[model samples]
Target: MGVVSVKKSVVLLSLGHACVDVYQGAVAALVPFFIAERAYSHAAVAGVVLAASLLSSVAQPLFGAVTDRRALPWLLPVSTIVGGVGIALSGVSGSYAVTLAFVAVSGIGVAAYHPESARVARIASRGSHTAMSWFSLGGNVGFALAPLLVTAVVATGGLRFTPLLVLPALAGSVLCLPVLRGLAASAANGSVAAQAKRPDDRGSFVKLSIAVVGRSITFVGLSTFIAVYAQERVGGGVLAGTIALFTLYVGGAVGTILGGRLANRWDRVTVVRYAYLVAVVAVAGVVFVPGPAFYLFVAATSAGLYVPFSLQVTLGQDYLPSRVGTASGITLGLTITIGGLASPLIGGLADATSLRVALAPLIAMPVLSWLMFRTLPEPAVMGADGSDGRQPAPDVGHRGAVAVGVDAPGQVGDGDARQRS
Candidate 1:
């Protein structure tokens, strides 16, 4: 494959990623509307979030394991449509039970889409960090746009207009075709053979996953209620919540891109640690600070939390080089969605106490993440042929490489690595 083809494939994959993730964002974006239209309590709406998350969390790793065994590029488009359909039908029915069922179905679609998509992205990106960051950015952009998309269709026509939400999924599925074809062509040419298996560092991966769970709880909790919280703090009604959600998501785009560039200079673990430290303060500001400046803190919290997003995915892949699909599943899908499981707890607490009091515990999540990251050593870089790239040293533990750089042996330079059969 040529550089142009690689860039094109990555771009298409990113756009498709955005389309599917729009529903993920839409789930949270729809919360305020669900409250206003249905008169649902905070706990009730949080259950809706659980419906979307609970099944996805369980199924993502299973999907990843499947992808690890064999490629399933077709899942990309099929899952996209399924996810969109589930979300589109969610609001059309008035029954809460039916709504939960549809959302869970959507969660399954999301679960199936991620592992295979992440594998395909790795193939397309040829292991470039910057490229992967761009791919992650697409999902963040989708999240940023979800509020506007939901407000435009559902708010205007109420939940009945949700059918229109499927349009992006349709468009996204179409966008996936060219990339799928590219993968097929590569496979036919024997350039897309099974990657050489490497030793799995289960220990480091476990620690990284724990840190991700902490990050997930913070992000999902904020996304779930930031809009409502914004309304309470700023008195701008739905518009305030929309803006707050938008800021929270859009800032992630900046953070992801920044993370890629920073990785070129600092170790991924180091970058993640500092970012979490910043997140601790920013999340506090969002929960406690008042007035319109709340938007600024929301953006800060987003950037801080997201700087580790793509880096963590790549780190997970490196840590478990032989199980890239499983790594991607956990880093990109399972741990992230698991945060939604806590939404009900937060909601129930809010119902029992004030929203402010309910949100106070979230301030410690990033602190825990920072602590976990402190224990992690970066894994050895895997060569193109699946060989470990680290040179033996007395100080380097059994975990392998303690740091990575653009010029590191076996590392692919930005936009330069391409598969050759």
Candidate 2:
């Protein structure tokens, strides 16, 4: 049993997410530049993004089902090839039709990654916040770095090479193969089943799934449009344009770390409520900030934004300790469709009312999220480990208790800090 732990599993998954985010989000930042280079319309770029989201958000559940039923170590790698080829093709795409087609293809690669990876994280992490935090950070860092990396590539080698840049990550994401093989080893040896199990593993985990979708809608809104909002609504410079990304993700990274510690100290629900309230405040501040201090307010608006992102994923694992793959797909998969489906409408609203109009959901979504969370049964996972009156997970020991913290059988020393949780 000294082999894989949830912590190790999540760390690998986190790294994978970083690679995928760069693959999927590079064009989001590059769209305006693409339009300038190709004379495309704002609406046309939005359409391309919309196409990617449709593939990503809608197709995820199907992929999630595949991950659960099958054990293809090459799934992530194969998808990366498709996505990388599609992205590289985007710059060279001759027509709008071709561009959208390539974008959608890349989105498919982007879409398949999360559910599969999240399932891995959940299994490896053993059902703990630390595991979820690592996953969140991996994805956050990946998404956050997309614009920077893509822009640098575009600047140095030009847009044509943009697709080529994703090749490394595209290739590297396949590392999951070895990891999956290791997991099979553990399962075959009975270490996994013996070490871990959760009560909710056999159930639907539906409520947790709903909460995940709600948070994703808001998270994607900021990730997808905060830059445009920064430039247009807040009047910030292009550099300051990532205000939401910077404030939300970096702060959420910090908050998630703290949340892990706090979950150990306070109730998980308490920390979640506080995090959601902060999101409500942050979104509102962005929506109705007064003149002048737009930068200051946008930064503040981003505060606490990603906390729920980390929280919801962790919470889902806690809710359905065994169904991490479903929870992962539920959290990230439905997002491809539900929140993604809202993009064109959101863009259309931004077009009609003003760029600031896009900020509408960014602000209101959290309040609605809070309302949804309120209806949820109090999370028992917070007091897990025999800490809060509940029995230790029936057959699962600390391994089962620490659901998201499992390290996997082979990669024992990746030096990931989130695992210390």
Candidate 3:
């Protein structure tokens, strides 16, 4: 098959990713509205956030495990629609408990889509990091667009207009049908067969999860508090905060693109380690540096932190090839969410001490993440025929050259020989 064909398939999966994550992004954007329209207390608002994070995190791995045992292509469309509908209903209820339930519904939908979609992306990608990056980029774009989308509709039509948010989910699911069919076709061709022969590495996956946890804490912390930090320092109202948040998100999107290229050039583990190293310094600059100069470091910190995002997902799948769905769930869903669990502690610290003190701890997380990457070994590349699970011969070509396995291309059991070449 042509490279163009493979890329088009990956793009479809990326679109589904974007559609699913839009709800997650909207949840964060919805917080202020809840406080203003419903007069929710800070604790109540925290509860709402917790509802979304907890269900999504806990259910994702379960969904992954289910997909590993059986393909759930239908889940792609179902989950997208469910996620959007849940968010749409959130504003209809004035009761705090009712609102929490609606948010949790959205979280569950978010959880269901990630693992299966990621697994499809992996199979269709044939082991190309650049291709997978496009998938990750879609989710990032959805997240970045959330505030604007939610704010625009709500600002014009009031909080009651929240139902309008569901349109994306509806449209996304309709558009995603063809993508799901493509995934099914890819699996039938040989992706599913390749998986049965591959072994799962539980130990490495656990370590990678830890590394993901560290990165998540720093990232979530920045997203949660950067706007506030900017408002205090920059002396502008919501606009200044919005600008700072935009810088971080846009930086992440750009970093994701660069990470794919860097991984292709220098190898995945090396790129992950160095990115975290840069993250440490950048985060410190964000904390200590004064005035608008700090915004530069915020962008720098976002870039460094996000460079490892998609790489980690692929690494986890490589580490546990037999359970790509489960690995996707853990890496893409569960591990990163562990950061949300720590938000209350950080908030308490901010209450007791200061925002600077709360943020100061994030600088150390990247250092720990860097240390974790040092222990990871390069994963074995799949043979052109993904059926046989064996490492390729060493130094088959020039420096940075990938060694092709002793299997014919486009055969069952040969995943995508494209990576080895």
Candidate 4:
């Protein structure tokens, strides 16, 4: 595909991504409304969040496996519609059980959308992590927009107008149709899968998963408590906390974009390694440093943690080339979900001890994750054939080593980085 064509495809898919994830974000925003309107207990509201998390994060692989088994581009728009509709209907329901059900429905849509979307994005990206970053940035922006959108809807018309929230999803679903057609057309032609021959690097993927778990735990913990941590650390109350939290999340979004650009010039694995190392320093600074310096480290740490986020999804797709959908599901779903699951424990620790002590564990996580990344062997297909198995740069000639195992059949490199014998 041409550059413009690829760009258009990525934009469309990213829109669908944003639309679907907005529901996930909406769930969080909706919790306060539930408290106000339904008088739901803290545990009950948590149940709602838990329901969304379980269905959305856990079932992703199943949806992905199905997509891998067959072409299902249709799921993109269908899931988008379902996701938004679920969220729209959530607040209108009077029964707590019914509300939980609606949120879970939205969560299911979120689950179904991710794997196939990531697969198509990888194809459209043609191996550009920078392009993939744009796709990921869509979801980040969506999550950020959720609160604003939800608040506006509720403030203007109250909970009754919540159904209006479905408009974005409706628009996104319609827009994604053409993008789906483009993806289907590309699949009919020779695809990225056809261009590069790769073995299933399951061993490496498992190691990557371990590393993701570490980052996820640290990320979600910080995300859950950064505002609170800011309030306590700076003694600046809610506004200061809000600003600190915003800085952290915005830094992450910016880092996701920057990492993609860096990947164009250097090895993705190298970029990931350096990002984690930076995270180690930043996280330590967050714990040890006080005052304004703490907020600076929060932003620095967020950037470091997020730089590799999109890269890992692409890497997972490369690792399990034959099961791209499944790879996307795991990398995008379970790892982060499991980390989110750990946040309560982190909170409990904070309850039992000081917030600083609870955060102390976070400082060590990046160091461990950085070491785990060290165990990741660069993908054999990375530079084989002079392409990073992604779309080649416009100026780069397609002259170099053919995919290493194209002619000879054997496994790719293992974690040790030794070439296949």
Query: Local distance difference test, per candidate?
Result: 0.81, 0.59, 0.72, 0.69
RMSD, candidate 2, Å: 5.5
Q: Residue 119 of candidate 3: its Cα lDDT?
A: 62
| Candidate 2 segments whose C-alpha is farther than 4 A from its true place | 1-10, 192-207, 233-237, 242-249, 290-292, 296-303, 318-323, 335-337, 381-421
What's the C-alpha lDDT at position 261 in model 2? Answer: 62
Selected candidate, larger lDDT, 2 vs 3: 3
Give the Cα-based TM-score of candidate 2 against the true structure: 0.80
1-421, model 4: which lDDT tens digit per residue? Answer: 4222878878887777777777866765665566566776444655676667677777888887665555466778898998899889887868878877988888888888888677666656655667889999887767656766777787577777889999989987887777656544433442232134456889999988878878877776666566667777887864565566556666777888988898878877889989999998998888778898898899899899889889888777667766666778888886446555666566567767876888889888778778878989767554435566443321100121111112222222111111110
- Which residue runs does candidate 3 get wrong by more than 4 Å? 1-4, 35-43, 185-198, 385-421
Q: Sort every candidate by TM-score, greatest first.
A: 1, 3, 2, 4
**Per-residue accuracy of model 1 over 275-361 as CA lDDT, tens digit each:** 999999999999999997888899999999999998998888777765667788888874558789999999999999978888889
- Please identify which of the two predictions, 1 or 2, would achieve the higher TM-score against the true structure: 1
Q: What lDDT would candidate 1 get against the real structure? A: 0.81
Q: Is candidate 2 or candidate 3 better by TM-score?
A: 3
Top model number, TM-score: 1
How do the residues 342-419 of candidate 2 rate in per-residue lDDT, one tens digit apiece? 666666776677756666766766676666666665445323234543211222212232222223422222121111
TM-score of each: 0.91, 0.80, 0.86, 0.80
